[model samples]
Target: MTNFDQLHRFIFNQANVRGEIARLDDSLQHIVHSYEYPVQIQQLLSEMAAATCLLAAILKFKGEIGLQIQGQGALKYAVVNATDDHTLRGVARWDEDLPSLPESFAELMEKGVLVITITPEDGERYQGMVALDKPTLAECIEGYFAQSEQLATKVILRTDLSEPERAKAAGVLLQVMPTKASNTDVAQDTGFEHLCKLTETLSSEELFSLPVEDILYRLYHQEEVEMFEPATIQFACTCSRTRSAEALRNVDKAELLQIVEEEGAVKMNCQYCHTEYRFDSIDVEAIHAGRFEDTATKTQ
Candidate 1:
């Protein structure tokens, strides 16, 4: 069986091409079980998680990448966030019991927009958007790369939701590396085409079952490829009580007091992790007084 929750990166030694493969097993299961999501939504979330990890691994900066899809259809929104450390979290919002749902990406997401955001630790944030016009999420991602990065890119995503307990998601990304001006004739790079064709032969079963090395060997046995050490990915939520407290502190004081008076406490729940943070009258008073340390102590 493949090593679960690991991402591997590789490059063609003879061509300006790079690739990544990310496989999620336990992490996918954890995300699926975190919420009472339908099977189709679970599958979509799994694929987005895998894709986020793959995209995060390719970035040279220390930060996070996010993929979001919003539409007016039954599925209101879906989002996946992946940090440079391979930690990921995601959630989706939709109308319950969506009827007669079509499986095609565009049909399911009526008037949808796919947005890709990259926030680097020490640089300006970047965002790219594309319409959900393709039949598959993978194709839409490819469209984003084509329009934003102007690089030839291909994305393949797969999810196995037959067994809820063992749900798995896996994906591959291939992109042409920036070449020197003198070598800008990408069309003449027959090696890149050959590698892409080889990668296209990958099956979902192979992606979920075979080891990373074995899969790479099977796909590029004839080519000289350099594979990097794999990075482990995990389902992790970054929400914290301190952050929640700060959010509460930023709210209008009178309104917060009103909530405290009505409910006897102010409560906040993290959508990503479903963690609940509660603050009583004393905590709210400390927050209004700017005594954050005291509020933390009281909450503890």
Candidate 2:
């Protein structure tokens, strides 16, 4: 069987249209492992994961791309992040039991806005946000591209629940870039429209099942397409005890001691990975004494 957790890129040989597809099997499964999420949230995270992976693969940065949504309704927040290398992690929060399956995006995330953040390795981070007026996550991202970058971009995503504790997500992105190459009045417009029409034939099952070439051929048999090297995508978390310690160090010594005295230990839990880190009395005292080294990369 073909590996599903990979990102593939393709280009229309005779047109300015280019595209990317990402399939997430392993990464989605991993993100849902620790907690038992409802069907609707599970599917929601799967879609967010797929979209984040595809966006991460295309951005020209070395750090990470984060897709975050905040709501004033049932679901308080949802977030997914993927690095340039396709390492992804995500989580969500809600107050009570949500519907097993939401009928639409509005049902799950009411009055929500999508926040996109790009954090480069060695520069200031940039963030862009858009209101969620679209019906699907793909459409929301497409809206971002149109408003933020002014590119003609379309995103199509699919998620399937074929087995217990397993999920498959796939998506394709098509974008047209302005070029200086001359073309007949009708040629370039016709070519771009044709490519988009071909891309519309992609089925959800085919997106999750067939290999890349078969899917490409099924969509665009008349046009010559160039496929690029694939990038492997997987689930990864950046949480660590050192990072937690740094956060703890930001608190006042007196306040920290009071918490330690009352609770006997300072407990820090990573919201992303759900990993817990505890600092007992002695550990807190050490930090107060300024005896700890850098707490950022200790786990590394």
Candidate 3:
């Protein structure tokens, strides 16, 4: 019955295929409003976030998975991260002084590369790269699956960021299931393409407004779909004063003290959540003096 801010998994009983749908409302707003980005920029980040949510559902790991795209064009980069618990956050940067903005994702990049990083809790980190030659983020992701997993995958990402305060994003992931049936009949089956066509007809309006069950019915009313328990998606930033101090620890203490003396405080802002942290001379000295516990960390 969940309408938004949730992800659902469904499988067709008659076909060897599975799909996932993610509806993001409040989660999208939390990220879209973190900075005063234009509608296009907001839309880009929304797609990345939705894609992250969908990918996280299918991938299993103990830690987190991150998707980042960098290009030699107007959009410098955009990245989104999703944890195993369904928490996600993202941010993007682009040229603000353009006379006119490009409407398509590919137009923003001259030579783009999308990187997917997997960091398991107890294992080595892994990274996979895909060329961003596709017209949209969804297609590029589909290409990634095609190249890396060698699976027939179709990804549909839709977003409405015209109203940044009430932005909504949704995505659908459809892929052929691996089974003895697939081992038996790879050429005779056309169910995967048929399901993808039904999924393709899902408009942004229907995705953003309808409940999961209703949307599933609209797409697969004739097919037998088995729904699994859904999971809630949320916006979470792992940025705090401690992490800020740890980030600052890399800088020279004397330089930090000079900045504090000039501005009366050293200020640091978390780009993910727009939270500001200030440190005075005492805080700076204490930080350098090892007053806070140190742990292996990275800036968010």
Best by TM-score: 1
RMSD (CA, Å), each prediction: 2.4, 3.2, 3.5
| RMSD after Cα superposition, model 3 | 3.5
* lDDT agreement with native, every candidate: 0.83, 0.80, 0.84
- How does model 1 fare in lDDT? 0.83
Query: lDDT of model 2 at residue 153?
Result: 79
Instruction: Tell me how many residue pairs clash in candidate 2.
Output: 0
Lowest-scoring 10 consecutive residues by lDDT in candidate 3?
179-188
Off by over 4 Å in 3: 162-164, 178-190, 293-300
lDDT of 3 by residue, 99-132 (tens): 7668888888769999998888888998999999
lDDT order of candidates, best first? 3, 1, 2
In Å, residue 220's CA in model 1 sits off its true spot by 0.4
Clashing pairs for predicted structure model 2, backbone only: none
Q: Candidate 1, which segments miss by more than 4 Å at Cα?
A: 180-184, 294-300
Largest lDDT belongs to which candidate? 3
> What are the TM-scores, per candidate, against the unseen true structure?
0.93, 0.89, 0.88
lDDT of 2: 0.80
